[model samples]
Every structure is written in C-alpha cells, then in structure tokens.
Target: MYTCAACNEHYCRRGELEKTPSNCPCNETEEVEKFKELYLQEENYKLSYNSALVEAEGYCKKTRLEEIMDFANKCDFKKLGIAFCVGLNQEAKKLAQILKENGFEVCSIICKNGSIPKEFLNIKEHQKVRPGNFEAICNPIGQAMFLNNEKTDLNIILGLCVGHDSLFIKYSEAPVTVFAVKDRVLAHNPLGALYLSDSYYKDKLHKK
Candidate 1:
C-alpha cells in the first residue's frame, strides 16, 4: 500500500506530513519509530551514523568511491574484502588496488573460486549458456566464506549476478555494500534502462 514512488509531491521530504499521500510509507509512524529505535543498536548505530555522515559530507561533491573510502575511514575499518564476478576481474583489480593504496588490507575473491560446475546444481545441458562445455556456477557462498575467513571488516560486491549476490550477502559475516551491479545489457549500468523506461526500453521491459 505504501506507494511512495508513485507520489509526485513527495511532501514527506519537505516535512509537510499533513500533505503526504494517504498511502505514503511515512504515514506508518509506528514502523518508522520501530526502525528509529533499531537504528540505535550497536552495529546498526555505527553503520547508520557513519553512512549519514558520508552522505551529508559527500552529497553531490564526492564520487561513490570517495564516499566509500570516507565511510570506511569514519568506521575505522582496517580490512576490506571484495566479492567480484569473473566477468569484472579487471575492475575488481583496479578497485582493490585503490583500496590498498588508501592503506587498508584488501582481500578479493572471484565468483568462480570453487570451480563448481553447473551440473552440481542439477542444471540441464540445454540450460547451460554453452551446451556440452563446462560452466562453473558462480560461487557466491564460497566468496563470502573466503572473505569471512579473512576476517574482513567490510565486504564489497563488485558485479555479482542477482541471486548470487543475495547468497553472498546472506553468508557474509561482515557488513556488505555493492560497488556495482551486473547488467550485461547495459554495460553493468542497469539504471540506464530505467532512465529510458518510457522510451527505448519500454517495449523490451514490458514484453511477455
């Protein structure tokens, strides 16, 4: 029922609570109060507080990379981990190098770390991207376990596939953040489709 995205006025952002749409999420004051209290928990407090500082200080002024560094610095994280897709190995290397240069211990794991075949998941040969060829399933759980073993202070996901990223986040012991998402159709920039939803991408997206 909370349809904030459909609301054009966004009165909540302007603090005009009385002008907010009936189905606006902000109308759920009890949920808001509950989350407010939850945010004060030790782990949640650290993340929420430091993230807010990063947002305020870096708003429109700093790139996402810079803000990540600033947030890590503010959180006093000494080590970082990257769980990256095999397709984005080059990008992961560059990101790891940057983090290392910034004086943090960096550990990077590839999605195909375990060399697990798709057959292990009972995937049929016809279902394989290239039939009759070995296709390793993306091992997000292994990536998370590897990073967990490294005792990383935080984990960054570079380009994990949709469900793979979910598993990674679920298994990660440290906090996780996404550096980028996998979107082969848009050079990993999925937002491009949304930006053109009413134009070039409307039919493609709405196709049966």
Candidate 2:
C-alpha cells in the first residue's frame, strides 16, 4: 500500500495516484527543479518562446486578450490556423471571425475535410458510435498538412476527439493551443469528470 502523507489516504497501487499536489507530501522538488532548469535554461529551442511567462510578468498591462494581441503585434504573426471537428463547425466559424476581427489572417480546416469513410480502415460497422451508415474518418494529418502549407504561426484546436487531437498535435509544425476538448456528455468540459468523480465517476477509481 502507498500512504499519502498530505491526505493520509492509503491507496493500494502506486500508479493510481491523483494528480493533486496535496496528495503527495513526499516532495520531489529537487528532481523537478533540476529537470526544469535543464529544459528551460539549457535548450536552445526553449529560448525562442514568447510564452505565457512573458505575458504574465506585468511587462504588458493587458488582459489575456490584450496580451495575445500584444504578442501577435510583436511577433508579426500574420497567419493563424484553426483545426476543428465537423460537429463544431459553427463554433469554429465564429472563432475564425473573431480571430480575423482581431487582425489575424486565418485558415480553418474541418476534421472531415476529405470525407473518407471510417469503415475503409476496417472499422466494424456495428462498432460505429455515430451510426448513420455514413461515417467520416477524422483526418487530423490532413488538417496539419493543410495548415503547414499555409505557413501558420500558430494553430488552435477546437473540439477534436481524443486520439485525433494527439495526431493533430503530433503533425502540426506550428505551436498548438487547445480552445476546446471533445467531451459530448459534459459539453466539452473534461474537468467535470474530475469534479464529479465521487458521484458519477466512482467506477473510474475502482477499475484499478
């Protein structure tokens, strides 16, 4: 059994630990700090970032919106990319409009851009979650390739399905930010599972 010092909870498995920092009283601060210094200080690629740390330090007196605008101004990032699922098309269009209004050149790609069938990949017909006899294969690679061709400075994801999102991120040349994650039951809010875990998701904890 693993005993959590901060929470005083005895858990059976080491791998089943909760991510909450208070759950781990035995601090690994030195190891974490050493890794951070190596990655953030020593890496040449890490030095090139105009990251959230710069925006948060009162170097710019703006809110997040204003800070993003300031960063965009400083970087002169003329082209932006949006990679979205077909289910979230309306939201994506609205978001694209907003980005354009904020003086960005936007290129948007839908997940079903090529409209290939899922069954062609040997997916069972009955196993289809959204069974309409017409299922479109999520083409995350295509979206990334399209955006890469457009030479976007940044790419944003809106409501991409779990594995598809990973593929999109893997293939994207530009930096990626998630606007929404796909969680149909909880309305795109994945944290709802964490919050309501005791009541609605107790099975998740018991599976191990």
Candidate 3:
C-alpha cells in the first residue's frame, strides 16, 4: 500500500508527516531509524556521501560515463570489471577500452564464458530461443567468480538478461553498477515502455 509515487504532498523532505497519506511508510519511524543507522558505518557513510556529491556536482553537467568515472575516482578504485551479454560483446569491448584509457585496469567477462549448455539447468529444448541448436547458458555466476578472483574494485553490468543480472549482482564481491540493460526492441533503453505508456504502448501495458 506504499503509494509514495502517487502522492503529491511530499512531507518526507521536511522531516514531517502532517500531510502524509494513510499508507505512507513514513509512519514506521522505528524501522526508519533502524535503517538509518546503516549510514553511520565508515564505508557506508563514504559511499552515501560521495554518491550524493557526485549527483549534485554532475547534475545536468556530465554524461553518465563521466559521472561513473567521477564516482570511481572518488572511491579510489583502480581495477574494474564488466559482465556483459554475448550480444553486447562489441559494446563491452568499447567500454573496456574507454575504462583502460581512463587509467583503470579492466576485466571483461562474457555471459557465455563458461560455455555451459542450458541443459545443465534442466531447461527444456522448447524453451530455447533457437531449438535444436547447441546454445550456451548465460553464466552470471561464472562472471562474478572470475571478477572476484581478479579482485576487481568495481563491477559493471552491460546488457545481462533480467534474471542473470540479479545473479551476477548477488555473487559479485565488489559493489556493482549497471552500465546498460538489454532491450532488443528498443536498443537497450527499457524506459521506452514508460515513455510510450500513454501512447502506442498504452493498450499493451494497461489491458482492460
């Protein structure tokens, strides 16, 4: 019942809840206080503070690439890792080159690196994108393990499939950030669905 998105009266900004709706989670002050304690940790504090500074300084002034570099530099990260889908190999290569040029040691791993077949996961032939073909399963775990072995300071996700990306993040030892998402029909920009929610894609998204 959390309806913050639908709320117009944002009382949270002023640290007050006089106008907060009935379903607002701000009413759970104890839980909020408990979670806020996490920010007191040294590492967590630096991450939260630096992330805010990055957002404030880069607002409308820098590209996402520049913002990422600024954050990495602030964090003093030297070794970076990229976990990418097979379809985005070229893009991953370009990103790797850019990171290397920026003075970061980059390690890139393809989703199909281990080359394990989908059959290992008990996936049926009918579920295959191309049936009767020897297709390799996307090994997000392998990508994370390889990067962890290399002791990467930061990990970037490039076009991993929906569930695969989650697995990679869960297994990654270092903090992870998404560089890009896969949206084949919209050139990897998934927000296209939201942008067209009231237009061409309205009927598809809001079926009556």
Q: Please report, in order, the local distance difference test score of every candidate based on alpha carbons.
A: 0.94, 0.77, 0.92
lDDT of 2 by residue, 1-208 (tens): 3245445444324544455344353345577577667766633234345554445554646564455545555556778899999889999998889889988999999999888898878888887876668887899999999999999987888999999999999999987777789999889888999898887788975575
For 1-208, candidate 3 gives per-residue lDDT tens digits of: 6988887878998867877777889998898898799888887887788889999999999988888888888988899999999999999999999999999999999999978999999999999999999999999999999999999988999999999999999999999988899999889999999999999899999887
For candidate 3, the TM-score is 0.94
Q: For candidate 1, write residues 16-104 as lDDT tens digits.
A: 99987778888899999999999989999999999999999999999999999999999999899999999999999999999999999
Give the least accurate 10-residue stretch of model 3, judged by summed lDDT.
14-23
lDDT of 2 at 117: 90
Candidate number achieving the greatest lDDT relative to the actual structure? 1
**Least well predicted 10-residue stretch by lDDT in candidate 2:** 42-51
Better of 1 and 2 by lDDT: 1
- TM agreement with the true structure for every prediction: 0.95, 0.72, 0.94
Compared with the true structure, model 2 gives a TM-score of: 0.72
Candidate 2: where is the Cα deviation over 4 Å?
Answer: 1-49, 53-71
When sorted by TM-score, best at the front, the candidate numbers are 1, 3, 2
